[model samples]
Target: MIEYRIDRRSGVATYVQIVQQTKQALRMGLLEPGDKLPAAREVVEATAVNPNTVLKAYRELEREGLVEARRGLGTFVRRSLGAAPADSPLRGELAEWAARARAAGLERDDVAALFAAVLDEHFDSTAKEQENR
Candidate 1:
């Protein structure tokens, strides 16, 4: 089971946040197939969000084939997003790198921008390399 959190300051829609967090949980292996998500009432109670917002999020997940809502029960995970574990070597190295970046005076946004650029470049290059092969 996963607890829901909302960041009203983020400017993102509440339902979108729920959808993203659910997908993130899938990626992190926190929610596996067959795992029941918190009831909409539970989410509403926890986050003070509208029931419709949670239902919208769950519906989006269902459309994406990531989850299914049973008539009598609750929404359940249907698929995984396939992410490495948090304790993986790559994650540890990235955390260390992030710490170093912070120590070197890089702000959170700067670090995120740098990482996104590098990730785009790496994937682009890898795709080109595959094409060449």
Candidate 2:
């Protein structure tokens, strides 16, 4: 199970943060289908947010078909965000790359920005190639 964290200074709403973090966990394969999310009360206790905020996040996830809430149990992951398998060879390679980046003194945000830029460039080139075809 993934623990939820909230940044009150983030300017994003607390409920939205909860929902986005859950989705991010799903994307990263930390939360898989059938995994139970922390109970709303648990989240409230952990984050000191209103119970309704947690419920709202869960409801939004349900609306997105990512999770389901059982009557007596708790919200469970219904689907993943289609990330590569955890054991994929690319994951190992990426880990090594991240280690190298850290060794090179790149901060996490800098690495993330570099990655996002490269990903965008790759997709843009692919789209242009498709258009040419």
Could you estimate the TM-score for every candidate? 0.79, 0.80
True lDDT of residue 42, candidate 1:
91
**Clashing pairs counted in every model:** 0, 0
Worst 10 residues of 1 by lDDT: 124-133
Error of 2 at 78 (Å): 0.8
Q: What is the TM-score of candidate 2?
A: 0.80
lDDT of 1: 0.87
True-structure RMSD, every candidate: 6.3, 6.3
Poorest stretch of ten by lDDT in candidate 2: 124-133
| Candidate 1 lDDT, 29-128, residue by residue in tens | 8898999999999999988989999999999899989999999998989888866665667888999999999999999999999998999977765434
Model 2 C-alpha lDDT per residue in residues 79-124, reported as the tens digit of each score:
9996666777788999999999999999999999999898997766
Candidate 1 segments whose C-alpha is farther than 4 A from its true place: 102-107, 123-133
